[model samples]
Target: MRRGTGHLMNTSVTVWRVVLADDGGGGQTEAWAPQGEQPARLSQPTARQREVGDQENAHLTHVVYLRPGVDVRRGDQLRQPGLRLEVVAVFEPSVRGTYLRADCTSRQAEGE
Candidate 1:
């Protein structure tokens, strides 16, 4: 994969970061805060890929590709309409400037 291929990212997704905010009762509460939205390519992994994830205990359901240096991280949530995916891991190509890949698990959205 080469850099500057904008067409590869056909879909958009909002990135949510998990923040621990202080609760009024002197406790910290976890909240999802929207970082921003960006173009991405999302796809369901094949059986072989799924099996690899399963063996690694990642339970990956989807793979998201974004521009290299995107701020996505493990535990971040990628949302689009009725879908919400929890990122299990983030991978960068050793060659650099290729693309960022996030292995995610699909979770049920509240409205769906």
Candidate 2:
């Protein structure tokens, strides 16, 4: 893999991490803090459908590819223009430090 091969990654996305901040009243507030932005490619969306009780629910799983050394982790989020994807897992698909692949799920479909 080569760095120049990332030309297909045209989507600009913001990476965010969840932080717990003290609320000053023996509680904490969960907030999303922006980590940074990166050029990424989102693809391979698969529909996951299941039945809970008498209702059927569906969610989408997508693969996100980022440049090497992009500090993305599980539980982080990637936000695009009209989409919010929660990172479920991260891995180096090529194992050559060329890029990072994140398996993400749609936050809206998860009812989050």
Assess each prediction's global lDDT (C-alpha) against the native. Answer: 0.91, 0.77
Deviating ranges (above 4 Å) for candidate 1: 1-3
Question: How well is each residue in 1-112 modelled by candidate 2, as lDDT tens digits?
Answer: 3355378787878999999999999999999999999999988654331122113222336788898789999889899866889887787865566788887777863454
Work out the TM-score per prediction: 0.89, 0.74
TM-score of 2: 0.74
Pairs that collide, model 2: none
What lDDT tens digits, residue by residue, belong to model 1 across residues 1-112?
Answer: 3447467999999999989999999999999999999899999998998999999998888999998889999989999988899999999878777889999999897756
Q: Give me the candidate number with maximum TM-score.
A: 1
Q: What is the C-alpha RMSD of each candidate to the true structure, in Å?
A: 1.9, 5.3
Show the lowest summed lDDT stretch of 10 residues, model 2. 49-58
Error of 2 at 111 (Å): 9.7
- Candidate 2: stretches off by over 4 Å: 1-3, 45-60, 109-112
